[model samples]
Target chain A: MAEKVTISTVAQHAQVSRQTVSNVLNSPDVVREDTRRRVLDAIEALGYRTNRAARQMRTGRSQLIAVRIEPTRDGINGSVLDRFLHGLTDAAATAGYRVMLYTAAGPADEIATYDDLLSSYELDAFVLTGTDHGDVRTEWLAARGVQFVTFGRPWDNPERHLWVDVDGASGTAHATDHLIAAGHRRIGFIGWPAGSGVGDDRRAGWARAMRDAGLEPAAALDRQTPDGIAQGESVAGDLLRGDAPPTALVCASDSLALGALQAVRAAGATVAVTGFDDTPVARAVGLTSVSQPLAEAAAGCMDLLASALDGDHAALGHRIGPMLLQPTLVVRQSA
Target chain B: MAEKVTISTVAQHAQVSRQTVSNVLNSPDVVREDTRRRVLDAIEALGYRTNRAARQMRTGRSQLIAVRIEPTRDGINGSVLDRFLHGLTDAAATAGYRVMLYTAAGPADEIATYDDLLSSYELDAFVLTGTDHGDVRTEWLAARGVQFVTFGRPWDNPERHLWVDVDGASGTAHATDHLIAAGHRRIGFIGWPAGSGVGDDRRAGWARAMRDAGLEPAAALDRQTPDGIAQGESVAGDLLRGDAPPTALVCASDSLALGALQAVRAAGATVAVTGFDDTPVARAVGLTSVSQPLAEAAAGCMDLLASALDGDHAALGHRIGPMLLQPTLVVRQSA
Candidate 1:
């Protein structure tokens, strides 16, 4: 068997101290360019792989980022999270990191898993998703100084942590504008029951677009319901039956838009329906929807996380802050 | 920080050899019960953890299983693979194992990922799915003596390794019988294009049941297409347009059956339809389908894998040849 390469070997080969070698690898900019070049040359010559395990023993860092994913049995499958997860995995791999996936029962179980993984030195940081008001996961991790970043915006803590979120309001605004450009006056909004940060942002975008178009948003046309195709279909049916029916419906999710399309067809009514998240079903049925740049946002997240893992607290909070990428609208036959 | 407990420390505390200590933890039955108890007591007393990294240095094992999953963009989300993956993950966790997920572009890329993961010592064993005739992966792994257990049955080399598969033949047989019981004289069959082992098995089951019932299978009523709802709907529509239309339709998957239902509704026909997999979509639409015992199959895969990882190769192929669990019929409003 070949002798395993270690940092000590690299340091000796480079004629440098162990901490100098560590600095060259983790904080290259801190090291002199000439010293860093020597370390890099030695690393290349010795085929010294970055031993994440031994590095964890020395620096208390694991080159592993954990994402808590729940395997849901809901009717809506392969939603935005799946795409984001793929993008995150790709970005992490490119950054010489690996992703560890684990499922937990709820917030409490999730926190316990995080604790266990962190204490065992199995993970260096965590990636959070589905942030809500008073998110316990973020609060617990922040108190412990656990390096983490969220895929969604930090609803409660804006300055304490790092996050990458899509501009949902802008996405819905474009969707609403598209419908209005198609000569629709009665624009309706279908979204989740309102306290959700993402949902509300999307609804506000539609309202803003309506007001800009000199149209008063009617309460009779606007409806909020649990996210699902059936619920969307039923609510859309009810809204269409109302005295002032909407000629165009803007849904917060593709699942809801799917239901609205079915309702419109069932009622033999023609209406432009726009959905968020250009999901597979939306593409199949040709539903106009907003598509988030998940890969770019994921790349942003990895960049922020890499800075956090390197102990760049200032870069995370003050310099970079939260990244918000714009989502583009995909026009299809349904709209 | 307190001194980290290692295997050598545990061996010294237990008054046993390092090999014996390893056997006690990995394959307890190989060691005497009294010696195992002593090692367990020492492990508890010293709070010893079997460091997977250090163990790999000695035993060349990573204690991690790799499962290649494709993040498909198909409309049929939460397909059978997702359920099987969840079951596998849960079963692996229960057995003190971790699962590593990786994505690949295609079969060639998947094989390359397996090779890379194995060479890096990042994965101890692999779990294969979607096996086909002359599967390059099984051939490659078998030639290298790499430890692996397939979730799908091996079409080529049955005696080389371990596998667990649900009995598709029996599942379709029961579905066919259910249709017959419902007094459907002429039942149509909708399935994927031929040459697939699973698809062929299911088609055979329907034929067997029809033959057993003293009914000749009608060739004209049988249709084969790619697995999709739209294709299923279109093909079923074609089959119904034939001179002798079937009173009921038996689809190979829920996606196909969903399309069949839509076609039936459009035609205002009362043809009972049955789909397989019984996924969330099937349950939502009340489509009667076949449900594979995924949890049991997953448990079997893990058990076989555990035995293989423990150096008990005899337990895999001889004692427990490829496990074929029976799938049951899930009756819903459609059938």
Candidate 2:
């Protein structure tokens, strides 16, 4: 099926020449308002929106900020990312912005990859996702005077960076409080590795919540591991094997919560489990987790980067607070 | 972690260029062969390579070809497409091309999306995936003189297209032959809708293959249905439930094979199922299939595209045959 909203389809649907449709959208001053309305209605009905890539070439300034995405085999699909990315793309597109996806993988060829973009740069700015601490990629882009943004707090010099990170500490605090409110004092935490800035914030959020609740925040109650579905299960298994385990467990991500679910089932118990990043899988599997507006977060970062690209790095090092974003205690079978 | 491959890194490895390295590569007349060898050694030791995108940009050609991808959620991970895309990137990077991802979903707002790119072109051409018949996006690009290459033939006019198709007719024939060789005369086919040109090619291939084996292609052997994982299973289930069911089935894709697998298991009967595309699901379930050489196909399309972008469409309408990529019969318990 060759599915695309072609100009011809729009032309036929609007009962106008392809030239008229183009003229109406491109230079509306040349068309009458009545004719424009007919064309607009047809465009909307047939879905003949403008193509940004071509538009950006003529204008020499694009709202199409790019983000480097590298997903693993078992990771989330573009659709899941789209659920939020669409929100972001829509928000950007409506404002005349677009999100461009750049392939930034291959550790063995870093310099080669960066150097390739030196000529005829298309991205108005870039948002780096899955950025780790002390990331060379971020630094390389920074050196090139390219506008920069990161999904998570980048590993490099964070103080001088432009980013829009979730208030993880606050999100974890909310999750912990919710579990506590449910009459579960023996709260446990599942945090990610030290390298991830987002993970660290999440751990701190849990700790802050515990402190506010007048708990000691014992180290034994915290389980540190990599952010993965399998890792959560293995670690959760050990925690559940203990004679006195926490009644409610908080996880770093929905992916980890999936593993926690596995361990919960394996251990033959109903320990409440919660996670961060309420990914689509969480809903499919009914795992309650923190709901971060990933697309919104991505969009916020893009906005910041757009400004930065225009030499307004003043927003660099800015942080968006714990947006409760309807954390919707999704109260599934697991938690 | 800001990685910088300094001249010293290269020089220390080759004991050459604070300057001689540049001389050898940039102004060879200024450097002797012995010096060039020293500089080259340093480059090798430092893992230094030239950036193809940059070199191409110098000639107003970018090694980056944008692919408008629309990967869905649900069970579809776009893994096959991603693997293929990455393979193309790797291959193209070798020939000086990096793949950029563009999200052109529906016709609504994408026209502006294209318009935005004309002023800031970052790619030399566009490689379109997920295109259907009468795709306006393609036509729009063609109108604007944007060079594009596609994976499959468009429905309306295959003659005007430049693509590398899956050799569907041959692949379907192989799938049929595989079942026939395994002692199965009756073979059922689960495919996309009738009007779908690609699916029709597969059905026709099945017919030709069956005819070549002196077996009449029965109507009962073909079941055209909606495109999806569930539909594959449901249609295949219907075929299997009949009083006289085919001993083997040929499916359009691994996604459909997934459904077929479920159908076979649910019915408590075992029958062989072969699929096209040889997707990951097929590999996971060990289903017999006709493997499509995505990387090779992508490369061939890219070759034709690059030539066109270089102002030579002499080899348009070129059709590369299906890769007889040794579709392995895993001989698993079920299949």
Candidate 3:
């Protein structure tokens, strides 16, 4: 086996102290330009590898950003998170960090995984998704003084931390308005059961658009069920079979909209349908839906987290207000 | 800030040497069971987080497994990797390792990333996907004596390394057999262009199944195109418009199968279609598809990687052969 090239070897080759070599690798901003260049040259010439573990022990930074890989539930909407992850990985790479993935059964299990990751890997920070009402994960991390940025806004406490989210309410409202402009008076909403901040926000968008247009956003026209294609089909089927069936339906998700489309076909009714998320499924089936700027959202998340990690006092204090990006209505055949 | 818990503090509390504490954390098998328990207890009591970098410097192991996050090409088939990633993370956590993600533009760029990740992070091993003929990434890692196990088989040199792969040929053959059993003699195959090892394997299955059923696997019935829903739809539409179109179509991916379903609908023809991957889109549309046991495949990859990392001489030398898992056919309404 070849002799191992250590930091000491690089230091000797560069005619600098081991501490100088360490500084060149970890905190290059602190090292003199010439000295840093000489150390880097020596490292390249001698094939010296920097042990990040050693750097972590000295600097308490691992350059690792942890994100929970949520289980794929109802495959249609699942791609939404997957796309965000791809965007996040790309953004993190550009910012000189790597994304680490962990799995958890739920919120509590995710927290335990965070604790394990913190103790074992000393992750620099976390990027959380699926934020909702009273999310204990954020509180736990904040109390422990761990840095984190969420992809979804903290519904219960928006000012508590940094976040990047798409304007879901505006998205649904736009969809409803488009249907209304197309001369549909009786519009129905298919959404998840209330109490979920995101679901409620989306539901409100449809109702707000209806009221603004002088159309009654009747409770009888709204249908609430769990988010799934089958559930959407069942609920939409019920709505279609009811008295004075809606001429247009705005769904909370593409999965629900896809199901509603199937119900429309089965019943041979010409009802316009719109979905949220604009998932690939929506594109494949030509469903008009809301498209979030997920790549921008991911980059925004990295930006907020990077600022916090750079020891920007204002960012660390959560003074950088949450970033809310607009969603666009991608018109397709369904609506 | 609270007083930091160091290894020395844990050693003092456990009444053991610092080296003993280190051994308990990194190589507990070498430490006495009773002593290991005492050190662990002291670590928990004092909330002593293990400095993985310090441990890495001492033992040359970071307990990190790196994998390249492939860009989502066609969103339909992209979920396969996402599901595999989730499963791999779950499996790695159970094996005392973490999965780290890096992105690269292509094969050459990916190898460059491997070098940077290896030099900076000292990643213990790599988990590779999308293996192909004459893959330079494998050669580079093998030459440098880096430990890796591919999620795909090394088609050019099967004996050179460890791999875990789903039997694509078996999957397609099973799908073909199902179509044949249903009394369809003229069956067509929709697959990627022929040089890809996986695509070729799947194509061969359809031919083999046709030949076994005492039917000529007509070249006219086979169509090759790049993997995409639109591509699938166009090619299937062409075939459907041609003379003597097949009664059943088997696709290499769900994306293609979905397009074929659309083609059939457009032609107003009664034809059966089966897709591979059984992606959520497939499940949503009720397309019969071939499903690889991805969670099991992930566990298998981890098991092989762990065995290699355990310093098991036979495994390190590639004595343990590659693991070939069977794929099951998921029957749905499309077929």
Order of quality (TM-score)? 3, 1, 2
Candidate numbers sorted by lDDT from highest down: 3, 1, 2
Q: Can you write out model 1's per-residue Cα lDDT over B234-334, one digit (the tens) per residue?
A: 99999877788899999998888989998898888999999998776676567999999887887888889888888786776564754888899999999
Off by over 4 Å in 3: A1-37, A41-60, A313-322, B1-60, B313-322
Best candidate, DockQ: 3
Query: On a 0 to 1 TM-score scale, where does candidate 2 land against the true structure?
Result: 0.64
* Model 1 lDDT at residue B227: 86
Q: What's the lDDT for residue B139 in model 3?
A: 95
Cα lDDT, model 1, residue A47: 72
TM agreement with the true structure for every prediction: 0.74, 0.64, 0.86
Go through the candidates in order and give the clash count of each.
Answer: 0, 50, 1
Compared with the true structure, what per-residue lDDT tens digits does model 2 show for residues A1-335? 33555556666787887667667755678988988788778767764444442233235565556654454444432323444444555556544565555454564355444443433244566666655667777777778777766666654555656665666677788888888888888888887876576678789988898989898678888999976777888999888888788888998777677778789888888799997766545644567777766667756765665555545545433333331232334566566
List per-prediction Cα lDDT, in the order shown.
0.78, 0.65, 0.86
Q: By TM-score, who's the top model here?
A: 3
lDDT of 3 by residue, A1-335 (tens): 44446666678899998668777776789999999889888877875533442444345677789988887887788889889999999998877778998888888677767765765565899999989898999999998899999888999877888899988999999999999999999999999999998999999999999999999999989999999988999999999999999999999999999999999999999999999998878877789999999989999989888788877777645645548899999999999
lDDT by residue (A36-145, candidate 1, tens digit) is 89988888798765554334434655567877655754535454666677787778766756676666778977776665455333467888877888899998998977
